[model samples]
Target: MSRMWLCAVSLAILCALSLPTFGQTFSRILFDTDMESDCDDAACLAMLHALADRGEIELLGTMISAKFPWSGPCADAINTYYGRPDLPIGVPKGKAGIQQGSKYAEQVAKQFPHDCPLYDDAPDATRLYRQLLAAQPDGSVTILTVGDLTNLRYLIESEADEISPLTGQQLVKKKVAHWVCMGSRYPADLDPGKWGNFKPDAESTVKAIEAWPTKITFTGGGKFAELISTGKRLKELPQDNPVRRVYELYFGGNVKDRHSADQIAVMVAARGTGHPWKLVTQGHNHIFPNGTHQWEVETDNPRHQYISALADGVDPQEVIDSFNELMLHQPK
Candidate 1:
């Protein structure tokens, strides 16, 4: 080979090796939410988009488990803001799920730019789940549900349809690598004890957990989420940002820091148990009929685990700073 050609090829190889390839293989994720009440869901969605921007996770689709008129649109609005305007958005079609008003869903939907149809007009969440799962490779998708289990329950119970011959449970068992849930309290949710996500759709929560075939990681951020307050940094972003609007509207014009359970859930789903989080895989989360739950020691089933703080725990401000950086990430 000519010396010039050899030099050019060598330079190319050197440059390729120098380029960063960290987290190159993206984590495939389907984010499901109930974005009608708290603002944390919106923050979580924004964090997902931000992680996608960083090439850490490939957001296959977003589904809303609630039955609010504007929740899907608000999710679409955030997706649109992050430059994925056509990302699939799904909602519960029937009146079987949580149907409530939001402090910000409507206002964010009205103010932001999105073409997603209203709740009733959107695609059914269960069907959407089946379709998304069937199309992905076996054991490749991680479902992150930071909401009521309505869609997931329907998915678990669905019969064969035009999408695939396999039932919902079969499809999920074939395709899903694991599930990361942002519901229920860890160890136990005692006393008046039913987390909002579980209580609203208690039956569904009980059923989905009982039937889900793969391992589940309950990212119970009840205590840590409160410590990891976020959303105030969103005010530093431009006024056109939908997430910024969500915080402002939810808090009555102030972008105050709110509990970050949903954000923590997203982080754990996209990235594994890193720093501050230690996985306890020795027990199973036992869900009661009323949607309340407790972690019981078990050796028979190893399909369930939950996150807890490290021995020394982590500085809350450090977590807040890191999460805010992700939440405020701009669309690339």
Candidate 2:
């Protein structure tokens, strides 16, 4: 080829590479949860809104796992608080097994027919997963699981080929790039005695860890939850504060209560500001008879990734501080 022609071809290739296709920042996030199970999930949903207010993340959808009976109402309450009652909210199709009669329940009901509609009739989580995953660009979505993994397991097993067209590993490599899970025990460091959320659906939790395409980060234990408290932060702001309203409603005048691990996990996934996460080891799929899920390092799993550190520990702190600051002021 002539020298001029070769130069022109090279320049064309460079320009094509430089052109932007999609402007999505930090990919997309899908928050899968059993919200009615705990106040932390509600708090986390509030924190997510705070981050969104700062233009740091994009929330794709919210799915309710089978762990909570009133998942739909809880999801609606959260959506209503965030001024996104139109966002997709999916609930489990079958029985939710657990009963609800707590402060969380009363708080969730306050939103009632307005923000929290009686949407026990929406599409199942698996169907919602298919639609969201299919519509998102390749490798641009992160499934943040803060509750039981039943919804994710259903998505993987039922819609495996459709949602993840590539091989189990390849599909994860291309479509769902990352999973931030808030379950499991941290061995000797943070024991289960410190946190009560990991006790639900241990079997499904193990299945999720095992089946997840290795690119998953497990943020478990009570360390992250203990470091930050929304009670004092919430009170620092007025009742109209978006973050405070969610916190106060869910917490119901008790602000010192520790939030959910799922909440912390989502914050880390979205911002990782104030909480320091240590990537101790890779996760496996082992399940105990008691339904307690456990994870160990595996050298063979190429599709897995446990967060060793969060941008030199700057991300977690920044996230916590930002949440505090946002809650101090009213949403613009």
Q: Which regions of candidate 2 fall more than 4 Å away from where they truly are?
A: 1-25, 67-69, 94-102, 112-119, 160-173, 188-198, 240-252, 257-260, 272-276, 281-285, 295-320, 326-329
Clashing residue pairs, backbone N/CA/C < 3 A, model 1: none
Report every candidate's CA lDDT.
0.84, 0.59
TM-score (C-alpha) between model 1 and the true structure: 0.91
lDDT of 2 by residue, 1-332 (tens): 89999999999998766442222245478988766656667667776666666566778888877434456676666566667777787765644223333346445555443343344556777777777777778888888877776677666655355545544434454678778877654542233444343455555555556667646766754555555544466666655443455456565565554544555576567753234555554444345644454444554355544442344546555646755664453445
Q: What is the C-alpha RMSD of each candidate to the true structure, in Å?
A: 3.2, 6.4
TM-score of 2: 0.74
**Global local distance difference test of model 1:** 0.84
Q: In model 2, what lDDT does residue 278 have? A: 54
TM-scores for every predicted model? 0.91, 0.74
